[model samples]
Target: MSVPKLLIFILLIFGSSTAFAQHEEEKFDAAGTILHHILDTHDWHITDIPTGTDAEGHATYTPIALHLPWFFYSSRDGFTFASGTESLLEKGYVPYHEGLYPLKAGVSVAEHMDDHGHLEIHMEEEAFKEAYVDEAVTVIDLSLTKTSLQMILIGLLLLFVFRGVAKAYQRREGQAPKGFQGAMEVVIIFIRDEVARPYLGDKAMVFLPYLLTLFFFIWFANLFGLMPFNSNIAGNISVTSALAVLTFIIIQVNGTKDYWRHIFNTPGVPWWLKFGIPIMPIVEVIGIFTKPFALAVRLFANITAGHFMVLGLVSLIFIMSNAGENVAGGLGIMPISVLFSLVIFALEMIVAIVQPFIFTLLTAVFVGMAMESHDDHH
Candidate 1:
């Protein structure tokens, strides 16, 4: 998943001078680069495949990714929807410091000191974060960012793929499974047997659909990022938080009266603890939220950190290479770096499926717990 991103981040780290040469040399900013990779961005950084060098010695980069639409809205700032970077700038939205800033008169432009530097252009999306700006506060950025784009793409993919799977069932009724349907049936049955039936019991069918959706949605998003040039969507906190929120909503909406009683008026506790100080009730209420919060943070942190590790290892190779000054030495270290990255990436592949199952399993567990009555418990 971090393949292309790791390479780009490596380029950014060991002096963008070697990587950019003529386009725009960037001073290595490790913090900015890591944060940029972990957090959701306006642009999806497809890999930069090198084209022929220009007459002026600038290396040409053919970026394979898409630039999603940029939307900015405010009562004073007015609304603007620009489909691309050029269009966004044309509308007077300055790309600066991880957000769209208002481009007003006398905006500070990037300067090059002949005594120390080469031509530096802040116009490109890559350099947007460090692009200097004096003014321009942010408005609502309802644009299709990396996360939103991935979500949309994955949603459509599920719709089409599962639609075909559904049709296969109709045409092949009572017949043996074939191809895609067969593969998915295996997963579907596993979820039904291991996840839904185990936790949900009698109401397994009622929640089976949601549990399947949760498992497939997450697993799909994770695997989607593994596709060449795709951005890491599941690693984003907002996306994980949304998944957690859905679990929370389902838990509360289906909670039995006993669930509320357990929280607000926890049983088996002393009167002093329950009514005198309101300690157990407060703790129980907080516990309800903590479950979902943990779900969100755990998924976000794990995926992000895994990507970070891969990128960091790749970056280390370049740093050791001294930006390719020592080609032999760099090549020597390449095998080790690649080996370690592959090992972790393989682990991440397993984690992609495991994490989703964990989330769905926990969600089912929570829901089942909430549905229990005094009679069932006793």
Candidate 2:
């Protein structure tokens, strides 16, 4: 079939599934539905299905979700564990939104909230301690969330693919590359020659492994996020932050004396700027941190915005449907929604490839700059 037809077919299948789930509720919460898909959670929600009806005759849905393990720690309970959120909830834990909280007897989670909608304690200091005297049983959530699980899957994929490719190389020592090996070789060479060598120069080989790993990991993670019924791994700020931190550490550790001097005692700048007020030094110091901060935010924002575009477009159909009241309106909007979602998905595919290259390139550039000598400036 044609590309347009294929997109329409896929969108129809996807949209209908989600719409059916949303229709189970009296009011379709577009924001909640969208957020639930985007955010990290303890459970992997595949889809929802109509199970039966409530006593009041309202529709009920049984979410086909994968319940992941929950790990929590608190001073009172020490290290505690549960099979999943359901088990914890059954054991006196309150399920509020995406998190679980332990409430004192007769004290509902809603009763403790302040005006701003956040959970806050307004009682006196002594009373506050008395209320939670069981040693702050608000367990610290260290569980492996959806994002972390997706990352682990990506790691396994990389390990398996590369291990196979490595065996192929051993078998065919000098033969002409073919099949998957050839495709993998093309990317590996591109990063080594085009990306790493230019910036890292003589040290390219030293950093080649790191650069290649960064590229493949980010690229794979991005592609995984685009898949249907998968978690948005790269879009999670925590993941990006960890990647950025790695780059930051490498750059700082490899920084030469000249790099440090350039920041604290800039050579070319006027003495007044360097020593009198120390403005330049402060700005330079801030730049050290801001570089990685920008890297993290850029990747996170681009990936997340791409998801929002696709999901938002798909959401239009259900929003226009008005809980199935305006069927004709929803049908009329389907074509437009599918077309836009297709375009965004295509653009996102390109972004998935390009963002990884950009990140690797910038990381190399930062490392190279840090290794620059005082003579290079002259």
Q: Best-fitting candidate, measured by lDDT?
A: 2
- TM-score against truth, every candidate: 0.81, 0.82
Which 10 consecutive residues of model 2 have the lowest summed lDDT? 114-123
Model 1 residue 242 CA deviation (Å) reads 0.5
Model 2, which residues run further than 4 Å from truth? 1-27, 54-56, 86-95, 100-102, 105-139
- The alpha-carbon lDDT assigned to residue 321 of candidate 1 equals 73
Query: Candidate 1 — worst ten consecutive residues by lDDT sum?
Result: 110-119
Q: For candidate 1, lDDT tens digit of each residue in 1-378?
A: 246545554555555444445334332334345566666777787677999887778777676666677887844457878876567555656555457666554544334312223223445554543454324455677777887888888989998998999999999999999999999999999999988888778999999999998899889988876555566877888888999999999899989988999998777778899989999999999999999999998787667767776766666566567666767767888898899889878988998898888888899899888887876552
**Candidate models: Cα lDDT each:** 0.75, 0.80
User: Which regions in candidate 1 have their CA more than 4 angstroms from the true location?
Assistant: 1-34, 85-92, 103-138, 376-378
Tens digits of per-residue lDDT, candidate 2, 1-378, equal 235544544554466557656665564566556666778888888888998988879777877878788877755567767785446644545444556556465544456654434344445555654554334566677788888898899989999998999899999999988899999999999999899999999999999999999999999999989998889988888889999999999999999999999899988889999889899999999999999998998888778777877887887887788858899989999999999999999999999989999999999999999997778454
